[model samples]
Target: MGFRNFRFQIVVRVLLLVATVFVFFKIGFNATLVSTQIFVGLLISGQTVALIVFMERTTNRLIKFLNTIKYDDFTEVFTSRGEGEKFDELYKSYNEVIKKFKDIRSEKEATTHYFQAVVQHIGIGILTFKKSGEVQLMNNAAKCLLQVPRLEQIEHLRAVSPQLVEQLLTLPAGQSAVLKLPHGKERVPVSLYAVDLVLRGEDFRLVSIQNIQRELEDKEMEAWQNLIRVLTHEIMNSVTPIASLAGSVAADVQDYLEAQPGTQICLEREETEDMGLALQTIEKRSQGLVRFVNDFRSLARVPTPKKQLFSVEEMLKQLQLLFQEEVAHENILFIVNCRPASLTVLADRELLEQVLINLVRNAIHALADQPNKTLQLEAFQDEDSRTVLQVSDNGTGISEEAQEQIFLPFYTTKPTGSGIGLSLSKQIMRLHKGSLSVSSELSKGTTFTLRF
Candidate 1:
């Protein structure tokens, strides 16, 4: 009904202004024309103002739409229907786009909240910080462990441990380190690892810290218990025989002296031989116990490794040569596999050899009575890009219970097992900053992995 066409409205406003000007000029300087001229002038001014307002309708709506977006006020709908079909469609499009953006922003915010909750609820203490010592996030565990109610900056940990802040900042991704923090009378050991991330156009480091004090204590206690059990068993075996034999020997001597009736002891030949045999038996048992104790000592006092880089193939070849005779005599199929041919590792050559030799010997023993016996020694890179030396044997596999205590000192399944081999191997691996682990199942096989 009004000037619905935008271009037509502009043309009509111009025509009205032109007509008003012509009428005023044609009737200039006359008293009769004054009222008419004033009326026309007022009409022209009114039309001009109206036309300006009409033209700015779309601009005004656009300004309002932009303000809504700037303020993140998406509740208002940019809807128009009456001005024209084109204006109606334009407004509808704006509304649709804004609604989509609102939905996306809502979804993004929800996802952010979900991850935030996960990070907070994890058991490991997590700290996310910027390069400038500004802490972006610190989980509840982190706050408790650091003994602070809140963390705003990494430097706040300086009081906890003078080097903690510096270590965390400089820690490389994928590598882990341990830090000791003073906790009252004792020091707490915290294992730390970090990952690098870029968020919101800025770099941040997410570090995880956990106290390993409880874990170390548990391991220590278990080791002591195992040691005590072994010591008690060995000592009892030796002491029991000695006690019984000493009493028998004393009675035998007293009987001989009493029967002599001359204040002199004279033992018969048979009695002398019997007592000497008993003494020899006691001496032998005592020596055996001494050797047993020495073995335990050796297991406990493993020498520190003198590490050197050596080729895996060369080591395997040497082992094969050293044990070739035994393998042949036992009719065992011994295999050595080294992937990439030139694989090498940095470790003490002698210690590593001892570990491998112990594992191989154990495997050989297990396969002694088994048919189709096979032992494989392999060296390759594992999934984590770490070098692994594995010894696998298809022999009588270990029971689940035995496997649990296999690495414990003085714990063994074999009858005459000194029980020090596997434990010593594990200690050697630890000294090399490596790991020794075994996987076995009854009737399937056992695999011993040495990871570096």
Candidate 2:
């Protein structure tokens, strides 16, 4: 019952007990006094017991209400529906407050899950850190990009690179920079982004890392393709007329010799021979133009995947034979150390062979100026159960400026280099579900590693 109704009932009960006492007094003087006292004592006793029961029930209900929220049991909280109207209003307000907290907790959970998924699924690497340089989040890509094979290396780098340190110090609420990670004897590139994050009412700088190497490679490829198109057109313009003019001049020389065979001097024969040599030069350049066209066509042809299980060691051995002539002529010593003999990788044979040849060729070229020119080709199964091949040289290592563009088509250091070799090799590895990468230090050496 409501407070107003319960109060009315209690008032009626007290009045009835008082009336009884008055009636008893009317019967006899002394008896009336005793009867009135007894009635009052009974009324007080019963009311006291009722008060105790009400207090116990109220306390238990309050305890249950608090427990339901504390344990996150968010069902309806209403119990003992018929009670003081004020108490009912109080319970309703408690329920509303409890639901608000529940909603907030749920939203927080969903947001956490969403961000976690985003960081994991993104193609680029991501690393998050606080303003104090504590690691917050790191994705698989970030780990791979940084060559962070262990947690220890990751922790160590937080203290190693000054660029990363400065980013943490001067990082505004939101900002980012690129980091050059040292791996072996070389550095890898990483793009870092930082933002201010408020956790538990405190602001922290959240730094994120990404690998923009792929993006850069893509842009470089586009630029080179455009350049190739323009160069091919211009060179063809020059080459075509030169070829025609050379042929015309040689023919005219032949006609003059034929018309005056008896009158022609020994010096004239020498002149004719000179003309022949000039024509031969034009012919050689024309042939080179054809070869250039063929290489460009090969790059454009992306074959449909035809995967097969093949031994990487066997592939390298075969490449050794393929380039045997060139290596022998260059007096370049070749060594192939393929161990655990049969490392079967799933890839296209032709494409992979081409990639190995390209890498070997690149190594040979790098060794050109070295006093002790030698290449080491090593192939084996890695700890991760992947096939690994390494091509290295003891030549003057790649410079920092050249390292960035090494895989870009037509980015060559050699006077006669076309520069499409490494770029094509990278594409071949990608098509075969593998990776091609390098590590180098200037004045020391360079190493190219392919993992499948």
Candidate 3:
């Protein structure tokens, strides 16, 4: 490879020696010996010149072939580079590398396109953002949810809510979060889920907002209807008899006084006893109303969160421990399948303890007389979002119609059900910025999904 200048010099010297030898022989200076030396030198010079010319052409062709490959002009084959057997081997190696790079480039573009389209079309809002808080892409759902304009679609969402922005940045790179927006005169109660993404060398996030006001309203209405139905039944049962007995007592006293006006008892001793029992009945109904009010007071004031992190699995386990005996009495089995050996939440320990206990206990009661009375309690990180802890059960599922009403105080499905259990549980979940929902079928089972 370094022989160019040196080889050229040798060729020039050989040619000069041949010409000098020819002149010496013509001038009769050892003419025969010099002529022989001139002939040998001329042959060597011709051979050396031919070799140098070939080498120069070959190396030039190699440089041209390399340039074409570097530019990815794979259309033109490296005929010059691969002509000779030795050079052909080198050409094959170069060709392989070029082909690989081309393949990778094609695949990379395809993947990028696929990712863009797929991410954009998903129902959940997807946003691609830079690590420095610049938005790269906001999908249709995200734009609509955040009220992003067409012109401002790709623009940095600096005008968004600061709480949302703060949550986006503060949550772990791969974690998710839920941001709440209360209902205003113009705005609806919105629940936004912020999910983070780390791809290639970039960071992005998805903020999925779902309108939950309607769902809550539905659940609330259900609870109210159920409560009213049960309460009306209870109150009427008490009030109707009280009114009848009071009327009868008054009539009896009037009759006795009218019949035997002076020095005679207004009513017989049995009548007096009957009147006393009727008054006691009225007091019992009044007491029932008072008890209902007290339960309501407790339901309204959920425990304030001592929002420290604690294991959700541990919570369920403890509930199992507390209610294991009850489950055994009903031949009910408790199953717990949860993630993180320690699935924890930032909530008040005592409050969450009671909430879980109530839900689990209610679940046991729900499966009261079913053929297969089994309760499965599982706490898992949400499939798409890791920050949420979802607790679900497989018991006697609530019907679509009844599922709506299960949360009202005193709204129980049991024959002697008091109905306040689910209402209190829902309030606790709300205190922790969580939710409880029931999805049930006729006879199969009920699944109460608590998301926190």
Candidate whose TM-score is highest? 1
Question: Which tens-of-lDDT digit does each residue in 185-282 have in candidate 2?
Answer: 87766777766767887656555666666787898898878677656764776598777878788687777778778974344677768777777778
> Pick by lDDT: which candidate is best?
1
lDDT of 3 at 144: 66
TM-score of each: 0.78, 0.50, 0.52
- Show the lowest summed lDDT stretch of 10 residues, model 3: 149-158
Mark the regions of model 2 whose C-alpha exceeds 4 Å error after superposition: 1-48, 57-61, 64-225, 233-267, 317-342, 380-386, 415-420
lDDT for position 270 in model 3: 82
lDDT of 1 by residue, 1-452 (tens): 55665557678888988888888788787897888889888987898888788868888888988887888888878766456667788889879878987998899999999998998898889999998989989988888778888988888788888788878988888789998877677789989998998888999898999998889889899877877887798689789988899889989878777778796677678878999999998898888888888997798789989988989999999999999999999999999999979899999999999999999999999998888989999999988889999999999999998988898877789988888899999989988889999999888789999999
Please give the range of 10 consecutive residues that has the lowest summed lDDT in model 1: 1-10
Candidate 2 residue pairs that clash: 127-209
Against the reference, the lDDT scores of all candidates come to 0.88, 0.73, 0.69
lDDT of 3 by residue, 1-452 (tens): 32334455456666666666666456564655876666666766776676577668767767866776678665555443323445666667666766777787789989999988987787656665666766677777666666665423333343656666676566665445555543333555555556677789676665555666677799889767866787787668657877887788788778888888798575568877887987887788778778777776777677677889877777777777888888788887778777778677778889777777777777776777687777887777777654444334455667777777678677677876656778888888888888887777776776777777
